[model samples]
Target: MRVLIIGAGGFVGRHLLPNLRDEGMEIIPTGRSPDRLRRLFPGCPVQQCDLSRDRAADWLPRLAGIDAVINLAGLIRDGAGGFDDVHEQGAKALFDACLAAGVRRVIQVSALGADEMGTSAYHRSKKAADDHLASLDPEGGRMDWAVLRPSLVIGRGGASTEMLAALAAAPLPLRLGPGDWRVQPLHVDDLVVIIIRLLHRREPFAGRLDLVGPEPMTTDTLTLTLRRWLGLPPARFLPLPRPLLALGAALGDRFGFGPASRDSLAMLAAGNVGDDSAVRAFLGRPARPLAQALARHPAMAADRWRARLLPLATPIRLLLAAIWIWTGIVSLGLYPVEGSYALLAPLGLTGLSATLALYGGALLDLGLGLALLLRWRPVAIGAAQLALMAVYTALISLYLPDLWLHPFGAISKNLAVAGATLAMMAMEAEHG
Candidate 1:
């Protein structure tokens, strides 16, 4: 059977595509970026389409000759479109196109807690699309639709998993909320299996299915479990008050940094547990627990390193920034101007030339520092900082070699700073 996989470039879609292909199903992947899709699934037919922007008429051509459509498109935070646009309007449009094109089946991958009573905007928007799909006439049109509301989906390369792993790898993980916010993490592999079953089933199944793991675990237990999987010893957690978490969430909202946003916190507080009976009956077996699922694929050396280093990225970046900014401040006025001029004298710089060198170097240091702190073209800025450091070291060695052996080891400290800068750059590239 031919299947159209929407948002096929996502984390879950990446895992699902290969498995479906192995099952002998012809696949056509669609996403906003066709180039990326082609790169991901080489030689596979792909179409460029943005659900948020595309109407039913625009999606009609893509729907032609499609036997089934599986929509995996979703956004944790708003990007280019809001939740309502991507989740509700765009989804409704795609379902309409599916119906108009005589497509018989659709599987919507929605989040748990997506219902009329959903508090978070993410859940509420998802509910809107699920409702629209359920409202469609299945019996009259022979349309078979199933909505899969999965809880926290844990797997390799998943953003949430990566974030949680980083937290677990921290020297002292911060306990967010009251440590009672529970989540039933469904392995991405099981989720894939469930979808395959729904697709291959002969009988029509219309309505929502809460796909969750056999066990529901609290956030603290979840973190400790991840730590154990990573072969790390348990460490005491630093408790964060609700006010602090709220403040961090506000900052995250403003800066778009980590995963501490208001919506996410609210959803966590509400809890994400559900009955696993539906999944068990559908799969003919119980869903794998978190510990068992993680044990199946042991954490590799790279995974362990990634988790450990990811948390340090921000701190290293800030340290580099502080070094540059303070050095600039010292050069500008804090340090005696005469001493700077004296140092420049060794390079044949004097009077106006010496003054310009001092101030110019200070401004350059300040600029690099601010750029590093703000995270503007971070990789590029890091390269620039490295180059500048090299130049400074070379000039200092040629002119004032004695400073290298000074009591403070002024020139020697640059080696450590340079290493830290390189580490920061590597982490940024990996995370991005």
Candidate 2:
């Protein structure tokens, strides 16, 4: 059947579009950006449409002859679009157009709390749209209408998931309220199956349903899941009162960073877990556990495994660099330190310039340490570290008269740092 998918450019679009393909639905998708739509459904018919400004009613005629309409089109645009424009105005635009086009079925992708009157403007608007979509005419029957309200969808490759990954690995950690707040996170794939099921459900289930996972997880347990999935070190949380949380939201408004909105914080506090029976009943297969989902979702878990080792590698590099540089520094007539004979002599660059050699060694060691720990530039710092060490080893053997004593020791230390630097660079190359 010919199906039109709106907001098919978003995170939801990525999975939903592909699943629709599996269902053999002839897809016509629209998004705010054509480029994103192209990436979302390459080679499929994708057109640019914006509910924010463009007359969606105008596109109604364009979508003529479509059998079903999937309205995933909504706004989270910094509270600017508000529920008024998107949910109310946008819904009417699509509804009028769909009615004119004789589209029999429409499935709305809305959030869990859309029905609540006092919810954030965005949610209030979504609920209004849900109410409106439910009110559509029944043509031959109640225009096969189903609404899916999924809780936080956990998946790899989405913006929220990426941000979650960053939050998981951050040294400063996140400032969450009491860790008691709970949410049921649905894996995108599992949620996709439900959405796909709604497209052509023979069982005849309708109306608003909360699509959520099997278990409820607190913010603390969520963080712990992130730690395991992301493989980051321990978190450092700084507490802030509810008033300050509002202040943080205001600052985010000023700074354009879009941290947790007041509504989002309220969501965290309220512990939203959508109803599960319909989804559980429909899938027949139980929802995957959060941990298994964490392991399975590659976007969050693939590079995730590397973040765990970053902290350990950082300190080890720092210590090794220190020892390498320290050996060079203490060798300059300050003490009768004898380790690794002269590395440079034939070029006639030694004596106090030999002191410059120690300075060079210090720079390389410190630079490499920072690079590995992500405190410094990877390419420049690694190069500096390797270059300086190579020079120092060669100069030491060449200049010191005790060159034959332990020549290999001088080369070995420089070689060690160079090897480590190269290894790090190689892994980055491979991953990139």
Candidate 3:
């Protein structure tokens, strides 16, 4: 059987492609970016289709001879415009095209808590699409549609899972209000098996089904489970008022950095859970427990270290930037010129030359710090800091060798700072 997989460049598609290949099914991956799709699914045919813009006529030609269409295309975090365009309008356009092309089967991977009266725009948009697909002509029609609304899909490679892991590995507990809301996280591997089974089922399946795990867990318990898996010590949490958090989320939304948002917080407050009967019936066994699923894939020392450092990345970067800016300020005018000249004189700098060197180095430091703060080319920033530190150490050793032996150990501290900077770079390269 040939399957047309939309959003094949996503987390689910990355796993689903290999599963389909193992089952000896021909795969056609489609996404907005042809280059990315090709990179994700090499040696496979890829088609470019933007759900936000394309219409039924645009997709009709691509559905030629396609046995089934798996529309796994949707957004979890986006602006309202993006949510409406991609989820609601996109689903209608694609489903209509599928009907027109006489595609026999279609499966939609939706979130578990999707509803018409969803607290978040994400849920509302997803529900709109799910409703549209279900309302399609079922009687005397060629389409056989089923929507799989799985709870939190936990996998090693998914972005959400990574975020959760990072949060769990944090030095301090991140308390989103009380962290009392519960969720049933389904293992992605298990979810994929169910999808493959549905594809090969003798009788076509229809309607929406919740694919959740065996047990429900509070958000606090979820974090603790991941923390335990990563061998982290128990951490304390400081719960702030919900209104304060909402304000912070609003600010974060405006600045594009904070994790919490109004809708996201509301969604979290509401909770995400569903019955696991359908999942158990389909798998012929209980769904994998959250801890078991996590322990199945052991995390390396580097992975653990990476997780521990992920939370510190932003703060460290800002600290380094502040150091540079402060140094620049002191060098510019705050520090006595006589002392600054005394330090520069040994290196054969004096008068205008000394002034230029002092101010110029200060400006360079300020600029580097600003670049680091802005998160512009993190790897390059780390490398530059190391190079600058090395140069300063060498110059100090040659010109004022006694400073190295001083009690303060000012020059010596750069070694640890450089190491920290390297760690930051590593985290950025991996997750940035």
RMSD list, candidates in order: 2.6, 9.6, 3.6
Relative to the true structure, candidate 2 has a C-alpha RMSD (angstroms) of: 9.6
Model 3 agreement with the true structure over 69-109: per-residue lDDT tens digits? 99889765566588889988988899999989999889989
What is the Cα-based TM-score of model 1?
0.90
Q: How far is candidate 1 from the true structure (C-alpha RMSD, Å)?
A: 2.6
Q: Which ten residues in a row have the lowest lDDT in candidate 1?
A: 75-84
- lDDT of each residue in 4-123, candidate 2, tens digit only: 888887678777888888888988888777776776578888877777665656777667788888888765434665567766777767876776677877788888777764456667
Q: Model 3, clash count?
A: 0
TM-scores for all candidates?
A: 0.90, 0.66, 0.83
lDDT of 2 at 418: 73
How high is the lDDT of residue 129 in model 3?
87
lDDT for 80 (candidate 1): 44
Q: Cα lDDT for residue 9, model 2?
A: 71
* Alpha carbon lDDT of each predicted model: 0.88, 0.66, 0.83
Deviation in angstroms for 390 in model 2? Answer: 29
Superposed Cα deviation of residue 189, candidate 2 (Å): 0.9
> Per-residue lDDT for 136-236 in model 1, tens only?
86552578999999999998878788878887888886576777789999999899999998889888779899989998999988888888888888899
Error of 1 at 274 (Å): 0.8
